[model samples]
Target: MMGPTHALSAGVAFLAVATPMSHYVHHLTPATAAVGTVVAAGAGILPDFDHRQATPARAFGPLSAALAWTIGKLAGGHRHGTHSIIGTGVFVALAAAATLNPWALAATLWLCMGLAVRALWKHPPNRPNGKLDYRDVAGLIHAAIAAYIAYQLVHSGLDMGVVPWAVAVGYLVHLIGDSMTEMGVNWLWPHPRRYRIASIDTGKTVEKRVVVPALYVGLAATVYLTYPKWGPVLLHTLQPTTG
Candidate 1:
């Protein structure tokens, strides 16, 4: 699946789980829920960081490119170690650890938000005259904004409890997305066998027509179903406070 599709699927998955979980998990405030959703969307492309050519790798220019190179080597190339069940656990653990410290959490959020913007935002295509692409500049602007938001969240003392589960679900959704592709993923790495439940070509007709639409519908349905709970909170957040 494409980066945008992976991200959309992960965001949808987070809401799907969070909607029901909210009923039982009383601490899931609107702020935390919003953060979790964004985090999940970002983490959806986390596995793709193992590929230098992936969207997340191109997100932050040389810095992300260098990280991707190191990760690709450590992960034994794309769709190998990072696409496995083991990789999910590792990422979740890292997220949990990041939540333990405000600075670390802020950094994590910044990275995730940057990744989310790069995947979700539709920047202009490259110029036909071989001029500079506004896409790269747009990414930098988004990165700056993401940094500010991350800092604000950390400063607000927002609950960090939801980070781990968001990361886990988002990462798993990514793996699941790839598993449905024609190439499939190595669910259990080092086993030398790829597993897939369906074969949909990435960015092709099946994904474009079926899977993408289903994800959008699912996102809308889950939002509608849970509006009764989070809707007021969102409205309240948006409302101006009396001095």
Candidate 2:
């Protein structure tokens, strides 16, 4: 239910120094700072794995597809498993596990990428099995590139320690955003019943026009308030200068 924009905004909000999460991540060095942001923001898109057309699924391709298939099959597909506490637990567990061994994680990603490429090239998308659609090719490439970027970041001296927490925080933020939608999440595990705000709808005028703009504002505000580049200046302006 949470759109990519809102989820990313929530991630940014969580990353902001003003947020509770800042205590753990505020000490990050310049190089790893953006990496932290990327981890969090990327994680924000995790819940949407059920929707093949969703950006998270598109960006992650076969990796997302596999996860979606597995969880969906377990919870009756799209919008059910991924929206429940049990499903969320599965996501967070996978995220935490990946950070424990970056090399193995990278290898898994490579395998997924290879499969995606094969699906796009060797096999036709229309097999009637709905495994790999022709439209998924571009997304697979993008997902592969994202996977490579993470691999390089791991190899290039970035701390993997920050990853699991960032991913968890981002995933939770996505859930919160989705809770605001009319079709809310099942939040409780093993229970299919959903809960929502009862007023908001996904992709409606309110979401596109109001919610999206609000997300932009929230992102901008978070950056202005917490970004190292701008935070110091804002604080400096707020404090009375010592003559």
The residue-by-residue lDDT of candidate 2 on 41-114, one tens digit each, is 65666666666555444444566666656655777766677777777687667766876787755643343333
Whole-structure CA lDDT of model 1: 0.82
User: What lDDT is reached at residue 223 by model 1?
Assistant: 86
Worst lDDT run of 10 residues, candidate 2, spans: 118-127
Q: Report clash pairs, candidate 1.
A: none
The model with the greatest lDDT is: 1
Q: Which one wins on TM-score?
A: 1
Candidate 1, residue 102: how far the Cα is off, in Å: 1.5
Q: lDDT of each structure?
A: 0.82, 0.59
TM-score of each: 0.88, 0.72
What is the Cα-based TM-score of model 2?
0.72
Model 1 C-alpha lDDT per residue in residues 1-243, reported as the tens digit of each score? 788899989998898788666677636887788888989999999999998878887776556767889989989999998999888888888889998888888888888877887887646431232234665566566667888988998888777788887888899999998888888899888786999989867565766788778888888888898888889988998899999
Candidate 1, residue 111: the lDDT equals 84
Supply the global lDDT for candidate 2.
Answer: 0.59
Q: After aligning candidate 1 to the native by TM-score, how far in Å is the CA of 83 from where it should be?
A: 0.3
Candidate 2: where is the Cα deviation over 4 Å? 17-19, 22-27, 60-67, 104-134, 228-243
